[model samples]
Target: MQLPLFPLNLYLLPGGISKLRIFEPRYVRLVKLAMASDDGFGLCMEVNDNICHFGTRVIITDFDQMPDGFLGITIRAMDKFVINHQWQEEDGLRFAQTSVLPNWTPTEIKYIDRDLSQGLQMLFDEYPEHAAYYPQPDFEDMAWVCQRWLEILPLGTEQKQWFMSRNDHRAALSFLHSIIDEELKDK
Candidate 1:
């Protein structure tokens, strides 16, 4: 299926939220059409001035007119997808045919981990508005916890694509452990 693309240099995982402010006529039209349909638009990252190979399917959860008069919308990423074919539309919105990427299975958080849970809380504490965008954090699911962390980190699209291609998030968890260890040493 051909879907409109919203390109940004950002990593968004399943269960992640993207708050967008749309003022462009094409985007405003895309938002309106997506809101009226069940299947939403394609959200692809712009890598080196081109659309990244990977993307996510987004479902509009909330919408409003911003104080600056722009159309504001919050969308939740549902699944990972890779672009198959793409082209520009007459309206200037790019459209792409994508195939869904394999998803990670949720793993139970076997033990309490402050780095995973408390770190997220600290983030929310510093940026209170973000707490409102997501439903309560999933402290019980290791995959959920790890994916959220990955989304927050500043990594290149290539690095992110590598991580996503892995069989599971055990590698991600190991890397995260090293970061948390260093953080503890600093404290």
Candidate 2:
């Protein structure tokens, strides 16, 4: 499938939610086009002035004109895709030919360590604005919890990309365990 691409510094995985402030004309057009069609656009990372190989296809869940006069839109990521080819339109908006990446099978809550979920919940407690994006957050599903951490953590773009490229959540769960365990030990 060909998807409109929005190359930013953000890493969004499936089931992740993020809010974007749209001001650039190209992205604003992308948003309008996305909202008009069920075929959502691709959210990708721009590395060295180029779009990364992997991205998430996201749908606009809500939108409004903010008080600051910019368009505010909340988006939910649906699936991950790998860019096969890309091109730009006259408006400078970019589009890519992509194929869906396989999703990680859902991991049960019992398999995920309790601290990981608690650490994620703590983040939600501290960042209500980010938390507000998800009215009903899933703390039980291991994949959901791990993806949330991957999105918020200050890990390098390449590192996050490597994690996303994996076929399952085992590596991510282990990584989160080490990080969260170290954080807990520091306290």
Candidate 3:
């Protein structure tokens, strides 16, 4: 499928919601087009002025005119996609030919996954603003938890892309465990 591309230095996986402030004329046009059509836009990572190979296929769930005079839109990721080809329009808006990537299967969060779950809970508790995005989080689903972690973690885009390319959640889960465990050790 083809999608309008919105490049940013952020990662949003399936089931994740993100608020974007659209100020540029090109992205404002992108938002307007997405609102009119059922197909949403592609949120791709822009590194060194280059678009990454992977992106999340997201739809605009909500929109509001912010007090700052920018368009604020809340987008929820529906799926992952691999960008096969992309080009910019005369207005600087980018369009991509993308193929949907399968999401990781939902796995039950076992006892071993508690640390990651609890750490996420702590994050939500500490940041009510962030918590507001997810009124009811799925802490029991390993894939959900790991994807959220992947979004919030300070990992490099290359590392995040590596995790997103995996066929399952095992590798991301193990990596999260190591990262969270190391943080706990420091405390």
Candidate 4:
């Protein structure tokens, strides 16, 4: 499970899609490789010198040259993974050995999760640009709901890594409650 790595604070969950601008020479090469191969690269969350073990394996779904002439690409997150080892090339492109994690089974969005549910709808309404990336959202799935929220919330990298490392997502759900509650208090 060797992969090319791109370390950014951005995270994408399984079934998530995001657009990225490729200008750095190293990343440009990495994007090309991901696009050309069936196996795509890993998107790691960079926290200081250490990258979070949890990451998403992404494949380029679309590509274009931006008006400014830099490469623009839209990637779809295929699945989650944990990095086992890593290294960098002379040009600074990061690569790693990863273990692909199991996809969560979908569950009906429960009543207790309505706030998490509404928050996403409010988000899409407020940020139409973010809404435009995902053509259809699987809001019925609790796993989908939690993962999407986890990606958007401004949680610390260590906290994010801690939540992501667990086999189940109960911790993430509770974390979301605190965040959603904080937002509710402000309004």
Q: What are the per-model numbers of colliding residue pairs?
A: 0, 0, 0, 0
- The candidates, ranked best first by lDDT, are 3, 2, 4, 1
TM-score of each: 0.90, 0.94, 0.95, 0.91
Identify the leading candidate in terms of lDDT.
3
- The digit string of per-residue lDDT tens for model 2 on 80-99 reads 98899999999999999999
Query: How many residue-pair clashes does candidate 1 contain?
Result: 0
Query: Each prediction's Cα lDDT score?
Result: 0.82, 0.90, 0.91, 0.85
Runs in model 4 deviating more than 4 A are: 181-187
Q: List the residue pairs that clash in candidate 3.
A: none
Query: Looking at candidate 4, what is the lDDT of residue 7?
Result: 91
| Candidate 3 deviant stretches above 4 angstroms | none
lDDT of 2 at 62: 90
Per-residue CA lDDT of candidate 4, range 16-48, in tens? 889999999999999888877899999889867
**For residue 147, what is the lDDT in candidate 3?**
93
Error of 3 at 64 (Å): 1.0
Q: Show model 2 residue runs off by greater than 4 Å.
A: none
RMSD of each: 1.9, 1.5, 1.2, 1.8
- Residue 178 miss distance in model 2 (angstroms): 1.6
Superposition error at 63 for model 1 (Å): 0.7
Error at 28, model 1, angstroms: 1.5
Which pairs of residues collide in candidate 1?
A: none
**Positional deviation of residue 18's Cα in model 2 after best superposition, in angstroms:** 1.2
Once all C-alphas are superposed, what RMSD does model 3 give against the true structure? 1.2
